[model samples]
Target chain A: MAIPTGPMDLVYRVLDDQLVDVEGQRCGRADDIEFDGGLGERPLLHAILSGSGTWHRRLPRPLRSVGARVFGTGLVGADVIQVPWDEVDDIGSVIRLKARARDLGLGQGDRRRAETVARLPDS
Target chain B: MKKVLQLALGIIAAIGGFVDIGELVFNAQAGAFFRYRLLWAVVVGVIGIVVFAEMTGRVAAVSGRPVFDTVRMRMGLTVGLVTLIASLVINLITLAAEVGGVAVVLNLLFDLNQSTLILLAVMGLVVIVYFVPFDGIERIFGYMGCALLVYVVAAVHLRPEWHQVAQGVVPSWHPSALYAYFVVGVIGAALVPYEVYFYSSGAIEDSWGVKDLNLNRANAALGFSLGGILSIALIMVSAEVFAPAQIDPGFLGTTALGAQRAFGETGLLLALLGMLFAVGGAAVECAFSGAYTLAQFAGWEWGKYRRPREAPRFTLAWMIFFALAFVVVETGVDPVLLTEYAVIFSVVALPLTYLPVLLMASDRTFMGDHVNGVLGNVIGWAFFVVILVVSLAAIPLMIITQGGSG
Candidate 1:
């Protein structure tokens, strides 16, 4: 929640219209902004990143779309998705994540979507 | 500039995705019958859509989950499935109506066999959806959809009495049962439940979250309000031309002539393009909504953002529904009848789809501090009440007014 203000507050911006991830990679778009203060005071930008849930959640009711959505938990939680302020590899054509999304936490429960469509002919 | 561009997706999506066949047909019908007398319904529908859409967007942005994903948590999976089924039915009817609208417009332009033209229209839609990549889908449709601006231009061109229009904007006591039915019709059509399902699901597709709340709010207000305005404009033109003549703009062709009467030949071309685009977009949205609600409920991957092969089952479900709707249109059913029925059934499904989203928006575990504020709850409940009344009265009104023509 706390975004740093100065250069130390270096927000991992996707400059010049850079994208976050490509293909079906574990990396996702900036889903949320994490911040720090002491667990609570001068809340500042702790990190900027995406959630694994965003990847799978992008799909509709009965199926999960993992391409940009997501599939694992390692890329989730409070820490895995967080890369401090130092790990944002390079801000280039894509904001390449330092670690693979699979290493983040791809698991059975991770990529599945909740059922929103009922009569989908079980294919 | 990139920030502007990223934000432009929200705006363009709002603009192009906002207006649909529902707005085009219903507003024209209302305008022909009541002029500005039912103007209040459009305003109300706009407010209702804004309250709920903003909530759904904020939930997606803050909680990182779309509304339907939370529906199962609140209602057990079975109840949630019931909602999905009900919502799917509404979406099917909506898709059929839009497909029919597409066919009718083709018939207007080419005078082809309605059945053959319907299949042609469906094919056009399938090709558009099948090949287009995901990211470009919204921007492409939204921008190309701006051609609908012609209806608003035509309304202004007609120059109706501003004083009389202002009076219609004020809600009045109308003794005519038919007029009351017309107001309910606009309210029903203007706030079709699938629009929110499609809209919020879209927020998820774009990977929006707490940071993008502003853009989401702007999308709801700008996109839906623009849609509501277009609906009113269609009504205005109809009222200006047909009200005096006492001619009902029942068919797609008649509605086009409403524009044609005001803008001459240019109006006809603009009307054709506008109707085709609006109807086509609505068909895509309704089909996807059917897919989105089901996929989100079941924990399956489903999105246009992915290639069809990636989420094969989810894509298959949506594609099946889309294909079925295409077939339904091929039966030569009248689009006007199809839309009227869709709106009424949508009135029934309204309470079901909305209640889950409203409750989810306020859930502390899901939404955290970003949950609905006091004003949000107030507006949300107020709209729910309106939905309840319409749900209760939809059938009776349809019977009593004999589908609003009596």
Candidate 2:
């Protein structure tokens, strides 16, 4: 696929799309997009930010902090995952990353819970 | 021949898995009170579910995203958050009701205490979730739910006037609040949001791809139609037995008596067994749907295809939902009443639940050439209007009728 040269091309194609790791496992969605330039200069896609923290940022200003707290992202101090644009291998129905979610530290909760599950007694 | 057998089993499982605690008593009560007057609502609901389920399956098969995933992406964060909160609340209520229904069924069967049965029901569900593979879960509950076919046989044995039954299928409206309430409840229960959440997610869990599009169509069309038939049969049986007696079949036990009245002891046992599995299956569906919605929206690893350690958060979400539902059930509320509330509240979430699926299914970007056809669009939008009106009116009607008491 041709690389998207303009912001319009990437707007719907990348923004809000579900993120899939190298193994095709769901990591999350592009809850917010980071642009490289401050303003006026040709803005370039920097990274795809995901997780409840990013989701909370999208809320209205009054609700943002409260939403984060209620969703437990703020309470737990969960950081938003940022995947650099270069790591995105393909942009299709889902945003496919070239790296594993674990390698990117995108699935920290899953990794943490996996350890707890590992210690549970077998039925 | 093997392919044909597989198709038949799929259809049977759909039929068996279709009715849950809400449908079981609500359809029965519809028949007992209004005879076949509410049959048209079931038809409307079945068709609505067929259209939506087919589209969701196609989207999942082709686009590889489940319903809630599309829901969150298409609606954006603010609207998506509202939908997510609504869906989770509805899911919890429905899950609690189904768990409660299971306890009631077990209590009736074993003559055990209801509170004790509720605890056992939660434990049994937890154990099943821990051990059963996704496919095994479907087959076990799906097949056992087939015992509900006793209602169909019982309906046939009653041998009602065929012409009258046919006439009932034609759309008719009643000004009575009670009638309108039942109509909304039946349709709402049929198109309950969790079914699509579970169905579309199941498509992904089963690893459906473009090659499975035909299978998806067959499953949605045939599976939901079969379920619709069972629902109608439940109404018919109740109409034949309870309508004449002027008895409202409020409890699960009362509904089973329709079968017993027709075929004696054997039919009653089959009906109760069918209720157990069907409601039990619904509890599992609700639990999984709750987890799937949360995990999918939050972008966590999810699916029964993964081991507990692999999808620990997903597993934890469902386990927590089951425990919460058990607590709700232990409050000594009537499970039947809870089912009614769940169905009504579910109607409120219908538009939010379905609008995203409809939009995604119609989008060429997502579905490619498989985008909804003209017929699908007409039916889809038409049902959207009906669902919107019902959503607005559901709560008011519930209050006015006191949950159809009048």
Worst 10 residues of 1 chain B by lDDT: B8-17
Please compute the TM-score of chain B alone for each predicted structure, in the order given.
Answer: 0.94, 0.96
Q: Kindly report which residue pairs in candidate 2 clash with one another.
A: none
Assess each prediction's global lDDT (C-alpha) against the native: 0.68, 0.84
lDDT of 1 at B234: 81
Best by lDDT: 2
Give the number of the best model, judged by DockQ: 2
Per-residue C-alpha lDDT of model 2 across residues B1-406, encoded as one tens digit per residue:
5444334323433543358887888889999998888889988988888888888889998998899988887888888888888889888888898899888889888999888999999999889877888877877777778788899889899998788898899999888999999988888877888888988898888788999888888888877887888899999999999999999888888888988999999998999998898888888888999999999888888999988888899999999999999988888878888878888998898898799899998999778898888988898999899999988989999999998888
Per residue, candidate 1 scores C-alpha lDDT tens digits across B1-406 of: 5544444344443343345555565677788777889888878877877787788778777765566665644554346656777888878977888888878777778889878877888778767777775556665666556667787888899998888888888778688878877777777776677777777778877888788888887777777787777777888898898888988777777778877887789988887887777777778778888888866664455677765655555676777887899877777677678778878888887777788778878777557778888988888999999988878888888889998777
Q: What residue runs in model 1 are displaced by over 4 Å at the alpha carbon?
A: A1-123, B1-19
| Model 2 chain B worst lDDT window (10 residues) | B4-13
What DockQ was computed for model 2? Answer: 0.65
DockQ of each: 0.03, 0.65
**Each candidate's clash count:** 52, 0
True contacts kept of each: 0.00, 0.70
